[model samples]
Target: MYIVILNLTDKKADAPAHMADHNAWIAQGFEDGVFLVVGSLKPQGGGAILAVAEDITDLEARVAADPFVSKGIATPHIQQIAPARTDARLSFLKDVA
Candidate 1:
């Protein structure tokens, strides 16, 4: 799994121009069964996406394709996590092993 952080490099006000494409990109992630969660970074600084991929390289390439990154509106920071434990409700994550 990966924690993908999108930190705004430009003004949040400039986001609207690329918002549609950005949203479409996110929607595609969900359709592809990669994105587990997607939401803002609080205070509206940017956004974050919880996703699953075969490897970090794949995830990085995926992140690179985001409109926010390609359009220079944001920078992506990706963290790879190997879950050793999880709540009962999230036991499914153990399958990633």
Candidate 2:
């Protein structure tokens, strides 16, 4: 599993120009089953994504492909997680870790 943090950059205001394409990228993540959850970072600073994937390298490439990251609207920091334990509802993630 991975946690992708998209922290807003000084160019945040330029985000509107690429909003549609960014949204399309997000939709593709869901469509491909990589994104488990996608939501804002609160106070509208930026966003975050919870992704289930086999490789951190692959996830890095996917994040790079995001319009927000590609266009400098946001900077991405990806955290690779190895789940040693989880609540029963999230047991599936343990196997992946």
Candidate 3:
């Protein structure tokens, strides 16, 4: 599993230029089953993405594909994790470890 943090770098006024493409990129991630969760960061810092992939390179490629990254709207930091524990309902996450 991985936690992808996107820290906003571009001005808020620049959002309109990239939001549509960014939203589409996010939607595709979910549709592809790579992104497990995604949401805004507190105080509008940026956003966070929970994702899983067989290889970190694949995850990196996906993150690179995000419009936010391509447009220089935000910087993404990917933290890879090996889940050693999880609730019974989410035990499946262990497989990604």
Candidate 4:
């Protein structure tokens, strides 16, 4: 799984131009089953996206095509994680072994 963190460098005023396209990309990502979860950081400074894919190449390609990236509204810092353990508080991991 690849964890992509998108830091919004631009101001909120510039969000509108990229919001629509960003939402569309997210919607498509859901349909394609590559997106795990996406949400904004506290105080709306930026946002983070979690994705699980076959490889970094695929993840990179998809993120590179995002509207925010294309418009320079955001930049992504991607990381590869190995899930060591999880608590039951997370519903999604309740049944995961």
Candidate 5:
């Protein structure tokens, strides 16, 4: 799985314009079972998004085309996650055991 962290910089003001597109992407990701969850940082500083993908390349392409990235609303910091352990409620955890 990959975790994408977005930090808002120059285009914070453009958030509204890109919101619709952002939501659309998220919806599509959910339908495709790629996105896990997304939320903004406290005090509205920036945002964070978590996604599970087969590989980094696929995740990169998706992030590159994200509305926030496309519109320069936020810069993304992506990382590969290795889950040593997870709650039993997580779907991925089921596969692990």
Candidate 6:
């Protein structure tokens, strides 16, 4: 599992220009079953993505392809997590450990 943070950068104002493409990229992530969750970061800090992938390279490549990254509208920081345990509803996350 990974937590991908799209932290806003100096070019944040350019976001609206790339939003449609960014949204398309997000949709592709979901359609591909890589992104488990995605949403805003409070107070206009950009966004975050919860993703799971078998290969870190694949995940890095995916993040690299986000419009926000390509356009320099945000910077990405990927944090890997090995799920040791989870609540009953989220037990599936443990498989990625």
The candidate scoring highest on TM-score is 6
Question: Which pairs clash (backbone N, Cα, C closer than 3 Å) in model 4?
Answer: none
lDDT of 3: 0.88
Candidate 4 residue-wise lDDT, 31-75, digit = tens: 998887888888867778877787888889999999888777888
lDDT of 5 by residue, 38-85 (tens): 888888677777788877888888888889888888899998777777
Measured on C-alpha atoms, candidate 5 has an lDDT of 0.81
Ranking according to lDDT, highest score first: 6, 2, 1, 3, 5, 4
- lDDT tens string, model 1, 33-67? 99999999888689999899987888888899988
- Residue pairs with colliding backbones in model 2 are none
Summarize candidate 2's per-residue lDDT along 4-87 as a digit string, tens digits.
999999999999999999999999999999998999998878999999887888899999999999999999999988889789
Tell me the number of clashing residue pairs for each predicted model: 0, 0, 0, 0, 0, 0
- Candidate 4 ranges with C-alpha deviation above 4 Å: 89-97
Error of 4 at 4 (Å): 0.8
Quote the positional error of residue 73 for candidate 3 in Å. 0.6
Question: lDDT per model, in order?
Answer: 0.89, 0.92, 0.88, 0.80, 0.81, 0.93
TM-scores for the candidates: 0.92, 0.91, 0.89, 0.84, 0.86, 0.94
User: RMSD for each model, in Å, please?
Assistant: 1.3, 1.4, 1.5, 2.8, 2.3, 1.2
Give the C-alpha miss distance for residue 53 in model 5, angstroms.
0.8
Please write out the lDDT profile of model 3 over residues 1-97, one tens digit for every residue: 9999999884655767889999999999999899998999999779999898889999899899888887788889999988898999989888863
- For candidate 4, give the lDDT of residue 14: 86
